[model samples]
Target: MLPTYSPYEGGHDAPELRMPTGFSRNVPERRIHSHNDYWRDVPVYTALSHGVLSIEADVWLNPKDDVLYVSHSVAALTRARTFQRLYISQLVDVLERANVHDHETTFFNYVDYYSQENEREPRRLWTSFYEGNMTPIRLLVDLKTRGNETYHAVVRELAPLRERGWLTRWNGTHVVPGPVQVLLTGNGINADVRAQVAPARDRDVFLDAPLLKLDETWLGVDGVKYGWNSSLAPMASASFSSATSWTGRRTIDPATEEAPLAALISSTQSRGFETRLWSSPRWPTHVRDRVWRTLYDLGTDWLDADDIEAAAAF
Candidate 1:
């Protein structure tokens, strides 16, 4: 077995190991992004099956075509190295085979470099998700243009899906499972943002409130988003906690942070949400053992391996 992960031994003690998530993303230099069965990588997959609930992927739509592909950058979106076909299929297979895809949310993060104009162009990239019976995967569009039109494009792309009865909400938000998950990410608060790029009719999608910041009305939604790199040390303590406040560095080697991690687990458990480490390269055997120990004790939730795989894979 690979040294990074302690093969899923025995069972657990913490709160039912509820929300385990891992980004399907991977770094190219690591020989992970291009692997055909990328999800099967020893450390990555084992960690996933054992617990991961959510998967993050970066999606870039082709400038010349309506097709949207996964990859950090356009240069990485090559036909030989990556294909939209295999990317979605394999992941669906893995998730379905694992049986988590049914209820678990898949964050199909859109990372297109299109300008605000292009995003609002009313172009929608379509794909067949086997489990939902072509249910359009819930997309989290990160406006790459940084132009005022990021939200415009998000609304536009979701239009067709709305008409087809595929769209559940209009305001770029909807309930995933626990209840009415009203999201604020889709609604561009920027007045500078364009209006031509608005999504379909806008009746069902009641987009509101970013996930990272806790809104007073966040009662029904089961999950929340944390700002990408925001330091969560304040909420790291007990009392004031939410999924959005839990933190650890993506680049910090999971192996080394065992003790502090255990403390974090105990700290966060009192609040409700779990924790996960990301970024730093794989650690050695003994360190990984400690890492898993923390997982057992704390019931940590997600680990972001890298975006290279998630974006490029599908």
Candidate 2:
């Protein structure tokens, strides 16, 4: 008879038995936005792990050092924590593994051996990178530095992803969706550069519109009237306070928020742009939960939050 095995006793400790299965990556993407994501314990991975695909990185272009440093403030900037190291390179690695094809094999054969036509042909069809969670991960690059140079610097740094066809780009006439969508936020996009790129069918970066003022034909402060569309600003945002003052007190009065919030959401969505609201009520955990649920009910595209885990769970 086999040795009497005690239920509590560990049998032959096998490696598979000793190590538990890896965590699931199939967690559905939540509308949660990870604000100032670099501050998190592990940057991009932290939010991704929490099923929050929208992550913001406040990048300051250090003119002297010529480095795009990711941080909330200049005082926190460090060379070791640059955006390339933390986000871009890591994304390349993740997508490379996810591609599931031999990079060594040329995708297009210059000369087809099987065909007597001697014409070029696809040696192996290009495979689109499959995001395990099947969510379009968005990277909100908040420009801490204002200038054409700084904007261009951020664009240059995106080459690793851009070259790999992983970045969402605008073709001459329309926008082509990619695995990662990059939105440039903080201080409007350079006007001159926008004008130049506006005609071009394809571009790697996008502008973040001020949703609160999107409907305004006349500028409140500058008194400048301008027409805007989806190509110019594919994503729009506003402060939570702009919509309502329900600061985590009593339940949000539908009477107060229903009309205004509905109009804002509808108008923004009509223009083919997603909407986001930052500076949401955070105090009183219950109020935060209520706000999160309210935003969900409103069908807000991206629910912005500093507490990524909590928001993702919500």
Candidate 3:
């Protein structure tokens, strides 16, 4: 028979153990993008907990201090919600915890063997649940300030992750996947991104290709023809409403809505770009589900979800 300890006794403390490498243990990575993730009560943590592989943050740069604040609008910006504090810092902490090992020698030996055979670096990866999955998670940055200045500020803010070699980068020939991939979007930012990343032999930052223009001749701000490729842009995204007229009724019209969307998805995928449709209908729970189901059926690469719980469940 076991004896119960008294409440006032001094021996009930929990045991201390080394932290595990699986920060997101058992949470399967999903292709859901946490839309406007900063709007959540706890931004990055909530999305990571839900196994969301992609997240979007709207950033406004203050020219005076060169600080980037995360918010949907300038009026809602706050000092405590800077991009560094909310996203970059938190991500760094998570990656550190996820990649660290209590037995360093064993981990290094294993990595070395794997690297020798593959002729490339081996990554433990951010998704700890999957043993050998090296897919990097996506962070979509929507710049709300002047294009060139804000783009530079965003790059500066990424120093922590960049210095740690945790950012996905494009080498002269191909892309080397890291734990996190930063994709730039939003107001008049194409020229700025092209100017900085286009000529570099190795660049960590990437651009989000326009989904609507993937099939057409995409011209940059400098009037140079730019092609959509995995090296330059990994994903193409657009609004759901812009692609379809269906209001999420019981059934979708085949020719007008379904066919066109499928074609777009096919086109984007053919160009080796992951497809994403944002600003999907959220009204009438069933309608949202219908649209999501249709997207999945059409082979859409990533689902833009405002409600992480519901999207995860689906």
Residue ranges of candidate 2 with Cα displaced over 4 Å: 1-24, 103-134, 188-199, 215-226
Q: Which candidate gets the maximum lDDT versus the true structure?
A: 3
Cα lDDT listed for each candidate: 0.33, 0.70, 0.80
Clashes of 3: 0
TM-score of each: 0.36, 0.78, 0.88
Model 3 CA deviation exceeding 4 Å by range: 1-19, 103-108, 122-128, 215-224
Give the Å error, residue 285, model 3. 0.6
Q: What tens-digit string does per-residue lDDT give for candidate 2 at 1-314? A: 45754344465553333311123235566777888687775777777677777888888888887789888887887778998988898777656554534333334342253234423321211122222233467888888887767777888999998887788788667666666888888843445445444454568787787887665432222334444567867788878888666675666667776667877888789888889989888878888888878877888898889888788767
Candidate 1: Cα lDDT at 270: 52
Q: Sort all candidates by lDDT, best to worst.
A: 3, 2, 1
Q: Compare candidates 1 and 2 on TM-score and give the better one.
A: 2
Per-residue accuracy of model 1 over 1-314 as CA lDDT, tens digit each: 55453333433422234332222222111111111123333322432333332333334444565444444455556553222343333444443342232243344322132223343333222222221221222222323334444443444554443444444343333222211111222223222331221232334333322223322222122233222111111111112123323233233344555455555556554544334343322345344343334344455543333333342232
- lDDT score, residue 161, model 2? 89
* Candidate 1 stretches greater than 4 Å from native: 1-52, 61-67, 79-274, 303-314
Would you give me the overall lDDT of model 3?
0.80
The count of residue-pair clashes in candidate 1 stands at 26
With a 3 Å backbone cut-off (N, CA, C), the pairs that clash in candidate 3 are none
